[model samples]
Target: MNLNPEQITDYANTFIKVLIDYSPKLISAFIILFAGLYIIRLINRFIRRIMVKRNLDPTLTRFLADILLWVLRIILFVSFISKLGIETSSFVAILGAMGLAVGLSLQGSLSNFAGGMLIILFKPFRVSDTIEAQGVVGTVSEIQIFVTKLVTANNQTIFIPNGSLSNGNIINYSLEKIRRADLTIAISYDTNIKEAKDIITAVLKNNPKILETPAAEVSVKNLTDSAIQIAVRPWANNEDFWGVYADTLQNCKQAFDDAGIIIQPFFKESSKKNNPTEQLE
Candidate 1:
């Protein structure tokens, strides 16, 4: 309380000297940080525009953009923290310790994510394609990063994980312009093979939608206990599959009936009303 003037002057001078000493480092760090951050933001935006211009997959573009921004943020954050007198070694160590745990917990999900990326890149199938995968057959409606959705021929919706789709076999029937229709018809053993083949061939030949290139094949496929099975295959456009299928079937039946061919229903014999005891006796 007694030496007030000198003490006050000394304290003020000392404070000013300390600030001047560290001001250079502080200012340098601030300038470097601001410039680096601004450049990072600019680079991220530029990268996004380039990706879009290249017509890259929207999901992939977004993912890459996020990664770019995160990397820049990490660099800036470490530098800023160091300026504030905090060590980055301990921070990086903590991150390394936790990263493994997080990755393990999300292993399955991450695998599916990778699978999704491959699907988008390779494009084995797309929306509206009829595909058979994971033992389910349906028309694809949406293919997302995590899952793929399908609508069945009966109008049922099915969702499959991207991992399963990529890991398993997939059959894309809609990719082809023409699909071969396989039909099996059975007739009584007494029926003439020549007449039946001719009649079936004529039925398919009458339809213009059926392709003549493959040449509809009609051959006796099997000789069962009481009937002869005929194998018929015809090629037609994908859009006309169902229509051609029904028409070809109806025509074959009509042709067989006109030629006096009797189609023996397989199960009628075992369930025949005739008494077995009487026949045996």
Candidate 2:
């Protein structure tokens, strides 16, 4: 099967001619590939700048930019392959099938991703907001594609899947600039309701954190066998809610003690009646 030198030269010439014919297409494809990558970077940077200017969420911004870049790169790759005389329709079909398989396999993750998108768009809560959701109460530390991170008051971290988070009941304590502190205090039945109310009202007024506009309320809420339950509600700035709440309780107790308003301990009468020896004393 050995060819003569003249035949070998002809074969070499044919190969060289084929290379010459395809040289421009190959060079153009390479140029397009590089140029497309550079353009993609530029587009990504431009999008990021716009997102920053618009004050979009950082997590969503980065995720969207990455998706856009990858999609663009995939299109560029398919185009490059097509330039080499490959059938891109079959390539696209293969990609579609692979995407469908991956989508089916990652259903939960995709749902979480969609949930994250909804959260980002609607903004039920934001980073640093104190929220109670899915039986976890904490400050939102991070909102990610699959989960939301929360830091509890005790400094414990919790990761909640976004899918359930989006669907669950969320109490965003930080949404309101002001919050009401509801405290219930019990006093002996013999204690004068008006006097006790006055003492508790004074406690609320003395606290600087409590708001003055709405006016604090202290009223008899209910009566049990041993004591009268008084409801004390005071408004305070959200940031000062806990401080106001703790301070009001302490101050009210002290004021009541000083004013001779007797606070009824639970089961005090029951214990006294149950113990006949103590009753004799």
Candidate 3:
């Protein structure tokens, strides 16, 4: 594999010529790469500042900024590649093909990502807010790019995918300042309805957590063969809703017992009056 002097010289000359021809493009490429990177950093910092100034969610701001940063870097890389005597059209075509393939393979993930973006943008619920979605109700502990973490009353953590969460019905209990607790109280058919309502109304009035502005009310809901159904509605702040609900019921029960209001066992076993859902506004 030995070469004569003439052949070696020819090879050396060719190498030097190629280096001389490409040195400027190579140097320009390096300069452009460094400059582009610096500009990208500045742009990312500026975007972060703007998001902070607008008081955007910290998680969403970081997510969006990182996405923009990578997109800009990819563009800069293409430009740098083209500067070094490379064909950018083919590079772009390859990138497009790769993007399409990756996108297809990650359809569900992309869907979740988009859903996360929507959740962050529209803000159906936020961290520390109580929400019911996809048949699960809990306090939102964290909102991530792909899923939301919920801490249930039982102290269990559940991850709900952003895709389904964004698409499904969401009940945000904390969105409103005030919520109404509805309790269905069942009394014997012979018990005085007006007297029972008055007793429950008194119970609601005495509770500190119940809101006086809305004026809690009790009304006859239905009548059964064995008992009568009474609807007790009390308003409270979101934080006091469950407290108001449980306390009002307990106080009404004690009050009823004192007033000789008979709670029929038949109603207790069958009626779901006490299980009425809380109303949020």
Q: Which candidate has the highest lDDT of all? A: 3
Could you tell me the TM-score of candidate 3? 0.90
CA lDDT for candidate 3: 0.87
The models' CA-based lDDT, in order, is 0.82, 0.87, 0.87
* Candidate 3 per-residue C-alpha lDDT over 1-281 given as tens digits, one digit per residue, 9 for 90 to 100: 99999999999999999999999999999999999999999999999999999999988899999999999999999999999889999988998999999999999999999999999999999999999998888899999999999998878899999999999999998999999877787888788888888888788878888898898878987787877888888899998888888888778889988988877665444444357342221
Q: Which ten residues in a row have the lowest lDDT in candidate 1?
A: 272-281
Query: Which consecutive 10 residues in model 2 have the weakest lDDT in total?
Result: 272-281
Q: How much RMSD separates candidate 1 from the native structure?
A: 9.0
The better-scoring model by TM-score among 1 and 3 is: 3
Residue 99 in model 1: shift from native, Å?
A: 2.5
Candidate 1 segments whose C-alpha is farther than 4 A from its true place: 1-86, 266-281
lDDT of 3 at 218: 83
**Cα deviation of 43, candidate 2, in Å:** 0.8
Q: Better model by lDDT, 1 or 3?
A: 3
lDDT of 2 by residue, 112-199 (tens): 9999989988999999998989977889999998999999877889999999999999999899999987767889988888889888
Task: Write out the backbone clash pairs for model 3.
Answer: 184-273
Question: Comparing candidate 1 with candidate 2, which one achieves the higher TM-score?
Answer: 2
